[model samples]
Target: MSLLAQLKILVVDDTTTSRLLLRDALETIGFRNISVAANGEEAMKMMTTSPCHFIISDMNMPKMDGLQLLKAVRTHKVFARTPFMILTGNADRNVLEEGRKLGLNNYLNKPFTPEDLKKALEAVVGRLQ
Candidate 1:
């Protein structure tokens, strides 16, 4: 649908498979500007150098983490209100609560479908008429 046309998206995940899967999903949904980060540390670096319109991150990673990244983003005035979505396998209540408090835009559990991703993006970007 090209709902994400020209919209920069930063996708952070530790697993190559997961990263590729998400990237492909976004592409299939017509997202043109998609970037990938292996972990939160890499994501932070990328975010600093190249700002993005949206960020979809995994909750767990080797260096830094989704929550840490979220906190950093919130503290940065430039990215404070940028849309951040957590895509995780872990569904811990505490984690979700923390994410909510940190101003996370949305949360999606693992094994999600293309529709799930589309819905989340729509929620953040608003449904394209």
Candidate 2:
């Protein structure tokens, strides 16, 4: 099987609809193993037990937010180099800059298409078939 098909990804979003949308987008991109967390705090807990290969998180979630999650992930020895991406509606450069400082691999603006998602993933982890 292709690596993309087996890549384990965690989708962290506060809203149920957003989580479902992101998960479906990942499935459409040929990723089979996906998990969802309602907030960054929950995502952190899940990461400890499940150990995903990647994390795609929303920036505005409560209970730890995306940047907090990114910092936490980067500080962890196990997930320090794991691919991390943020999904944000805000176009503020400060947010992206902050993510960069925190070792973010890539990020995508909200309401993106599957093609955009593929490109973002490729930018982070290389070309996806």
Best by lDDT: 2
Off by over 4 Å in 2: none
* Local error of candidate 1 at residue 114 (angstroms): 0.8
- Predicted structure with the largest TM-score when compared to the true one: 2
TM-score of 2: 0.96
Candidate 1: tens digits of C-alpha lDDT, residues 4-113? 66689999999999999999998888787999999988988898899999999999988788999999999998778889999989788999999999999998999998
Q: Give the alpha carbon lDDT tens digit for every residue of 1-129 in model 2.
A: 787977899999999999999888888988889999999999999988889999999999877989999999999897788899999998579988999999989999999998999999988788887
Candidate 1, run of 10 with poorest lDDT: 1-10
Clashing pairs for predicted structure model 1, backbone only: none
Clashes of each: 0, 0
